[model samples]
Target: MKEIKRDLEKFAAEKFDLIIVGGGIYGIMLLLEAVRRGLKPLLLEKEDFCGKTSHNHLRTVHGGLRYLQSLDLFRFRDSIKERRWFLKYFPEFTGVLPCLMPLYNKGIYRKSVFRIGLPVNDILSFDRNFSVSREKHLPGGKVLSKEKTIELFPSVDTNELKGGMVWYDGCLTEFQGFYIAALKLAVQMGAKALNYVEAVGLIRQNDEVSGVKGKDRESGKEFAFNAPVVINACGPWSRDTAGIFEKDYPRLFKKRKLLWNVLFDREALSSHALGLRSKAGFVYFFHPWKGRLLVGSPEKLVEKSEAETVAPFQKMEEFIRDINEIVSGLGLEYKDILRVYPGVLPAEPDGSFSGRPAFIDHHKNGGVKGLYSISGVKFTTARLESDRVLGRIFRHKKAISYDEMLSKKEICCHSMAYDWQPNGEDDLEILKKIIKEESVVHLSDLILRRTSLGDNPPRALAILAKIRSLFDWDNKKWDEEVDLLRKQLREGFPNQKPRGAGNR
Candidate 1:
């Protein structure tokens, strides 16, 4: 079976039941669901699949415990069902994560609040363990004593401490690998996916959208993909992309808010994911990720033009300051941040992120038929929302078997850190595998997307020559590719340089 490939000529030649305009997690899941339901879906990505805004996730598969604050049990249970789907389907890449939030008598963080809330959360999601594997079963919520909480995590603040709340959720062991696996399954099941294909505009026939007009980014050529239905699943760019329609319809996406997370070089502070409230009462999560600390979710309202991949310097500084204020003992400096993960989410009129996964059938709203756009809120529920919403359009009696889809082996991408090092026997072999099969177009695509080599700059810098040896680029092209890679890396860490790259 074909792993992800860029055969725009072949893809554009085929007829499709549906055309999806983004290759983020939502689009990927939608394409897979479309295939499982016996629909021919073609997905187009402007860049490498999941290499843009969608790649910057905090890696937590949320179960919506926070929604319990407002007694939004409907959403909470929906999150539980979705979280179970990930654990049950992708068991190898996802697992149960123990979550702890220290109570400090702050508004909702107090023990008295959770004493009643925990049991209700348990009662509502009682069927959470219904079909999941024995190893992946999630235990009910619990409230720990102040001393026991401190025993489990000593770094939490003790001033006005009211105890701790412990619960379980799912976390992606390998974020990119899990996403790529889904895409691979979609490809195997007959969904057409091509990256480096940009959607220039829509092709409409009177009151209906017949296809999408696209441009191949790899080659400067234009093409058309004709489908009965077109879906705009471009995450943050949905609003801007919808502008191309230029119809007298309601705006598909409202103003968006910038949400960011910081990956500190320090090791995990505790075995469980810790949620501590700042002096200003905003709660922040500092979780243990691959032996490192990952803290998140500083937010700001930004206009459509101002949405960017990196958070502003002052905003990030304030975010780190807030984190330091909550846990002064662990002074996390800016230099300690290895990477900054940023993305934008559709916000309420008041800039709050309290919305659900939303979609607009432009046919019903104001524009042409067969044109629909979706604005996704969370990654945890992308699969659930995709199935629920798309089922309305393509109804069938056949049930989708997760075992059949996930169990079948396909040629998928894997992290090359184990094999891409110096003196490794398969250094060249694995690099060739990624390039030959994984739709690699540039050196940065190989380093940043197909593998996790870019996660560690020094190691990636050291492996440049081996990577170069696999490609046939000469002189100017190699230098240009290296310069592009450096420019992309510098966006995350402005001060990052080639450290110890030549030492070997």
Candidate 2:
């Protein structure tokens, strides 16, 4: 892969077709989509790519299994389409994941509902395996016998446990590396992308948005890029970013909620990603990610400011208690949480997450022309959503399929390389190449965002010195970066009390 070449001068010099703000999944996909249609696009990120909410997912790609609840065939097909896209295109980065939900005798969580539901789902998604490789192919959902469910999940709560319904899904195996790979592909296809550059404001001439006004966070130097059109795909901060449009700007979010997943540092509970309903009737999922039990999706209305993404301590305690209650003998507690991936997402007034992706053209809204905003709650359909947004722009040229690039071997940065190392550090050659290309602005960029050493803060701290030789930082600069990375880790993984004895 060619170096990401962080060039501010080149950014200011180029006159682009589109200027995309926000380097999260949505923004990155939009940038790639623009390029695929032969449009020159410039993408800017305030921090490293996927540094915030995008990196906080459970890494499981949903295939609209829940949409079956309401018989939403359109969504079911759309989800299966995107899930298949991820599997077929990025074969190295995506994988088939079987997800099981423990069945109960009563309520909607029973086998009878899914027996019909699964067949309908399978029939609608008949084309799921079209063009997909054999290894990545998804199997039809099935109803497991109660004895089989007991065999798989030995400690499951048996109060009314009938059996289980297991469905297939996809997951990002490379974590943030998938984000980085798509970004690298965009850059290779003649798109310009820069990290640590903030889009401060929009440059509007009359009613048309001329371009984006940007500032380098490291140097405090400002620059402007000219583009006829601009898009705001800035996840949680999208509201704040588009706030510049002022009153009459349509409300982007009806409501907001704090969504988070906890990476419990315990042995994984099952081979298949498991879902179980608590006594409170909230269905919680347990994902087996990189040997840890990744449990998630506890949500509440946005009580705190959007910036406070760290989940509340009391809420986390409650989440742990709920999980423990679902499976007997699985006595988990707060300290068992090695890392908590938290983010803010748009929600409905009743606290249900907004299902649809929203994209707005300001000109249509009677606001600034040549400017648009997009916010999507789910990551699985980001590419499809971007294609829809850009399909409106360049209507003639078709969006390129990622399957086209299958013949070529693209460069990928495995962010979690350190995790697999027998020793504490990654291979020196791999680290050297990452430092040379992938825009290494700080130690935290490499440790946290670029490589997932940040997933386990304490482990990242332990391996910090081992990789010190990769950076050219002097004593003082090195110490400063280390301190900053430590502070960031502490904030993301708060309440670092040790796991109590016999708590497992």
- Say which candidate scores most in lDDT: 2
In candidate 1, which residue ranges exceed 4 Å CA deviation? 246-251, 396-399, 407-423, 492-504
- TM-score of model 1 vs. true structure: 0.92
What TM-score would each prediction reach against the true structure?
0.92, 0.94
RMSD of 1: 2.7
Worst 10 residues of 1 by lDDT: 493-502
Top candidate when judged by TM-score against the true structure: 2
| lDDT (10s digit) by residue, model 2, range 220-309 | 999998899999988877877888543323356767788788877787788888988888888788887866788888986875354457
